[model samples]
Target: MKVTDIVDKLGLTVFSGHEGLGREVTGGYTSDLLSDVMGHAAAGSVWVTIQTHRNVTAIASLKDISAVIITCGEQPGEDTMAQSNEEGVPFLGTTLSTYELTGRLYSLIS
Candidate 1:
C-alpha cells in the first residue's frame, strides 16, 4: 500500500513531510526501542511508535522508513518535525494506541 493509503485508513493527520505520503509502503513495523527499531524495521515501511523524540526521526532515517506514525494521540515536537522534514520522512499523528495502530496499519499495508 502507499503511505497515503495508510494515512487515510487510520485517520491519521500529517504533521510534516506530507508530500512524501505518495511514497510506497511495503510493510509496517511497530516499536519504541530505538535500537530494536533500527535493527528490524524494513526500508519503505510505515513505523508506528509512541516515541516523540528527535532521535525517532534519526532512526527512521537510518531505516529509510516511509512514514512515522506517532500513536496514542502524541504529536511530534518541533525538533522532531524538523528532523523528519530534513530526512524527507512523512509524519502522521493519530489517537489510536500502539497495538490498535499496529493492527490498523498492518491491514492497510499488508
Candidate 2:
C-alpha cells in the first residue's frame, strides 16, 4: 500500500513530506533506537517511533524508509520537518501509543 493509504486507514496526521505520500509501504518497523532502525528497518517500511529529532529524518532517508510515524501524539521539530520534506520521506503523527500504532500498521500491511 502507499503511504497515503496508510495515512487514510490509520487516520495519521501528515506532518511533512507531502511529496512522498505516494510512496509504497512494503511493511512496518517499530523502534526508537536510531542504530536499531538503521541496522534493521527495511526500505519501504513505515517506521513507528516517538523520536522527533532531525536525525530521525536522516535515518529515514538513509534507510529509504517510506514514512516516519511519531507516536503518542508527539510532534517533530521544525528542522526535522524541513529535513523530512527535503528528503521526501513522509513524516506522520498519531495519538496512539507506539504499540497500538505498530500493531495496527502490522495488521494492515501484513
| Candidate number of the best TM-score | 2
> Which parts of model 2 have CA positions greater than 4 angstroms off?
none
Clashing pairs in 2: none
RMSD of each: 1.0, 0.5
lDDT of each residue in 6-100, candidate 1, tens digit only: 77777889998876888998988888898988788889888889999999888888888899999888999999898888888999999889988
Q: Write the per-residue lDDT of candidate 2 for residues 56-100, one digit (tens) a residue.
A: 999999899999999999999999999998999999999999999
All candidates: TM-score: 0.94, 0.98
Superposition TM-score, candidate 1 onto the true structure: 0.94
Candidate 1: give the clashing pairs.
none
Which 10-residue window of candidate 1 scores lowest in summed lDDT?
Answer: 101-110
Which ranges in model 1 have alpha carbons more than 4 Å from their true place?
none
